[model samples]
Target chain A: MAVHQRQTVPQAADRLMPSGAAHHEQVVARQRRGRIWAIVFQAAMLAGIVALCALLLNILNQSFGYVAIVNTIDPAELAVDGVPLNELPKENLVEILEANISAGLMRRYEHDIPFAERSRENVHDLILERVVEPQVQATWGLFDSIFARDSVFAEADERFPGSDVYFRSWLTTSFISKSQSSEPLRAGVRTAIFGSLWVVAITILFSFPIGVGAAIYLEEYAHKERLLNRLIQTNINNLAGVPSIIYGMLGLAIFVRILELFTSGAFLGIGDQSTANGRTIISAGLTLGLLILPLIIINGQEAIRAVPNSLRQAGFGLGATHWQVIWHHVLPSAMPGVLTGTILAVSRAIGETAPLVVVGASTFIALDPSGPFSKFTVLPIQIYQWTSRPQDEFRNLAAAAILVLLILLLSLNASAVLLRNRFDRSRAIA
Target chain B: MSRSAPIAQAAISAESMQGPVAGAESTSESVLGGGPPLDLSRKPRVAESLIQGFLFLCGAISILTTLGIVYVLGRESLLFFANEEVNLLKFFGGTEWQPAIGRFGIWPLVTATFMASLIAMAVALPMGLCIAIYLSEYAPQRTRSVLKPILEVLAGIPTVVYGYFALTFMTPLLRGIFGRDIVEIYNTASAGIVIGILVIPLVSSMSEDALSAVPNALRQASYGLGATRLETAVRIVLPAALSGVAAAFIVAISRAIGETMIVAIAAGAGPNFTFSPFRAAETMTGHIVRISGGDLSYDSIDYNSIFAIGLLLFLLTLSLNVLSQWIVRRFREEYE
Candidate 1:
């Protein structure tokens, strides 16, 4: 042992002497590489965040610029009143454009002469300067106002009358307005907005009760040994990961044709069998509901699972019935989670265009859907339709519509967070 | 120490023996409260059975949802095959997807879907793992508390916003850098990259949980062995949490596959069977949207193709999800 210790001490002495200089250099080189890599990794992370922010800033800057610059064109200066609306004077152009948009020319540009043949600047230019620009300006202000509106936009509008304004409030009014011609400058997403509302309402109605009930049963009632229950728990988790487009396919098969329940049959015994709205709003809603069900169930289960077991035990010990224990004890404790889950699920449902599009939710209805079986169009589909057009105006409208949808989504999430905070505090107190 | 220690040990042993018996006695006492409190020999048969039944029913609902999924997918897929004569091998193996030519081969859509998912994983894995490392090892408690919630908010942003960002910003930026024709207005790269961004939160959050699950003692031992904090984390803690990290990756991949809006809005709808990520290509979901958009008859081959694609997608995602769950369950760390 003493000899081995003497050898180890010699090895240490070698490091202290010049003999181990190469080893020390090698160790230093390795440490330098490691430090360099760590620095690189940190820089890369910072770069990612910066890149994301830059992308967001770029979109905001470009779209706002488009709104500002494009709106500056005075349609009154390009007067050709003997001809189409785009040829009229800027002051007359605004009046004509508003009248045309109100007359549904904005939504159905194909019927207008400008759509048939691209006139000078197309009909979209006049529509842009008059209808869409003003509309986006108004809605943009409304959105800013929702989050404590500063005077910057109001000041900009006041400073630049009939010129480019700061927060174009036109998006709000444009969003509420109906669809327009391929001219994005004039197009709006009103039809899509109404369609999204209907679809979301139906999705929530279908998924909420079922999801919460399933969670309640799983957390508060299910026996540990039940194989069937175990199988379900497993499948729900799996289902949560299933691709959403698969749901669209399911909707197509189950809701559109085979079911033949809502509008698959001959509509009013007049339209050809091939020309019916087989894909109705009901099918779209059901498909979306199923798509988001697993999300709701998983979230609901987590929340329910988070509830202390002692609460249930306490309820049972207090002579509460089994249903009472679940209803009064377990359900209330998990309400915040359920609420957040519901909000998230609804947000997903509202934004889903693929599944609904597959289910034939793309029918361009002029008016709002009056019933579950009515033909519907949602915001994404509307944006898609507008953006797909060759005209540049449609692109602007798509941006404005996107802003509106973003606002709705943000508000919904904000409310959910608020609700969660309130419930969290209450639960802590209890 | 001598008196209290033995007494505490004796109390614990005695309580273990008596705990269950006492629990049962209390339960009986609640039900048979009108009788003697000491003579708790009765069982609350009705109460116990009722509770058991309620739980069984809950289990049954879950069973029902699963059955419903299988039933729905099975019935439609069966109907699809009953009406069409698609050679399964050719559908997957064929290099083209031209419906006008009567070729129902789906290789293009499958390729798009897989390529996009691969790109997403490629971007998300390293980035997510690194962020997990920062969160679990480096970040202070207050910083972690702040950053985690912000990351979650990023996840909660509606996919439509991501889609818009891809179309309006990412595509334009890429085009400017690479030249106009280098990237189409609607290309797979933008969607794939943005989808990666969408799934980052999922990957990082799950991986952090996994890393946290690794015992601190293991980390301390590695440090005691003269390893740096970074080395200990990368070598010891990460290895211990390898299974969990893998599961998180799989789940993130699954999420990328299922995502629709970003792809639908940003990815081009042209269904060309090409492997070029920069090209405008169609996905299985994208094709479903395109075909459904067109005015096709209910019984047309094009209509039936939707279900076929859906069935294939379902099978692919279902397996990934199941595998993820299996990995999570098999390697989950348990604490005393």
Candidate 2:
């Protein structure tokens, strides 16, 4: 009788649970849809990451791969066929190799081939040497000629022309040791590197103190909601986004022409004295400094803003002056962020070739810049000069320079990150 | 006992305090508890007034920069018009740009600049929007983490590199694909395409932020109403984020307009006023670069031309930037 009663009660319970059962089903269905959406979102992000990796990999392969191959050309053979460095014998081999390799690599390296010099004695003498020597040969014996059309092996020269000595490594001790050349094969980035460094150094010196000072004055001392405050805020934002080349034009008009303290005179000045007045490193740096000043101010302001109001209150409570509170407490707390911003600005300045180019960062200068007043070039400008040449050797030089630039940019960014992490950890401990 | 103890304590305290009271009287009693409390309370207004002055000075710097724009551009453009025989209408409508031949018409260069930038935006918009969609909706957390930084890196690569890539790699690639040399080594197509690529990050990052701002609850509601993930995204979240995304797109367009190196390097040095993407073209900034390349004096018409171009370019970008700010303000919702 009791068992029968229990069965009857369960039946009643089932009837009562009909609405609750439907609601439970509805909740489960919604959750299933949410999970599916989450999966889809995750998948899309993964695809983006994969695509990004592929692009970077492709750039590295093309750029660094060329570096690896160019490092093989025998510098001595290249030097023997001198005057213009494009006459280097092994450079031609690299071009042929570049053309036949992977379609992408072939396309990239096709313009770097070196040319041969005309024989000096007589018109017939040149023809005779060409006839006797057969001009181009494979480095790994005649057997390698079968694959000579391949882009990877095209750069190999069997022996130095006119001499039986086997030639190797076109990127010689002198490749890095030399100055800029119209011949892409012979061009080195030493001057460009120094120019870049000096330009960036001067830019930092000019922009940092001024930008930080302005930020401090605005954030710490300046009262809020005033007309002047509003104006400054608006200008900082607008200046940050102004086209850099506009600044270049301004630099040309203002520094090069208006003041004219330093006139361009050939031999003593840049390539054309009368035309390129005020085209010195100082002008370029100052222009860039102005270009990035707003960025610094905005970043500095944010760092200052991040300092807690409680700390300021505590400083006031301790009988510290307003300036004392900021100097002792707020600035120390904000230093890490300020440093990070400066690093990012420096990175931007280093990578920027546009405004600098607009302001006339010389395309082809054969010597390193010695001082701030010197006319100079940077890596990008050098790359532009090299890759523009009709010859193939310069293409390789451009690739190498690009690799160096990428490495430099990457390392700088990495250091900034490392510094931020270190600072954050220390702050946590404090 | 308690009353006697209290009386004894009071007598002892009164005896001790009497000497100090006499000493204070001898030193001349303080007045109004070291002056009125209301006087001390008024100090904040003085401090605030000083702060107001400091803010004014800070604001002046920005005002100066803005004023400098008008002064520099206005003065130079006026001088240009004064020196020129033709007026503003003819200059704007004129077909020729041969400065050496003494023609000062800037129409052709302007059109070409617009055409290239338009093409860049056309390419960048779809690709960037798609990438942002993928990042916001499709990618896994781990994937998003890795890819976001890489995209930023792509954006960060120097423009010079892009120029070289366009000149060497892109030109050849396009030529091969077209089965004919559709693009010259210095044609607008390569530079425009590279600019499109450069702008991808700007659009994608901003759009991602916009899309992320849409409430998850809305997506849930849409899904609960029997919509697919795509449907929900398109019909609900996308509409909600539309204004912000539009603002982002404009900013990207502005960036493309201002791009100099890629155009200067990949785009030919020619000032041809043609609309063909296959031809070498010049932009306003490009013209500035070209004009500034010569041996012109500060006050020369050639030098002044740069400022004229610069001023126009600045105004266009400044207005676009202002529009972007307006959009952000109009559409932004306060979410706690």
iRMS per model, in Å, is: 6.4, 12.1
Which candidate number has the best lDDT? 1
**Per-model fnat list:** 0.38, 0.29
Q: What's model 1's TM-score?
A: 0.77
Give the CA lDDT, 0 to 100, for residue A12 in model 1: 59
DockQ of every predicted complex: 0.30, 0.18
Q: Per-residue lDDT tens digits of candidate 2, residues B1-336? A: 123322222222222211111111112233223443232222344554464455445445555656765777778888877775546876787878766666778887787778778888887887788778778766779877878888878877888787777776677777788745566667788788878888888898999999988888888888776565666776788888888899989898888888887787777886887888888888887777656654456677676667777888888888888889888888776555
True contacts kept of 1: 0.38
Question: Candidate 2 local accuracy as lDDT?
Answer: 0.67
Q: lDDT at A26 for candidate 1?
A: 54
Off by over 4 Å in 1: A1-31, A66-170, A177-183, A262-278, B1-85, B333-336
Q: Looking at model 1 chain A, which ten-residue stretch has the lowest summed lDDT?
A: A1-10
RMSD of candidate 2 to true structure, Å: 12.4
Give Cα distance to truth, residue A88, candidate 1, Å.
18
Query: Model 2 over residues A352-392: C-alpha lDDT tens digits?
Result: 87677667777667767877767878877777666666655
- Candidate 1 residue-wise lDDT, B1-336, digit = tens: 123231222222222221112233332333232455542324455765665565555445545655655666676556656754566666777778876676767888888888888888888888888888778877789878877776776776667667777887778877998888788888888889888888888898999999998989998898776566677778899989888999999989878887777777778886777777888888887777777778877666777677777777777777888888898789776755
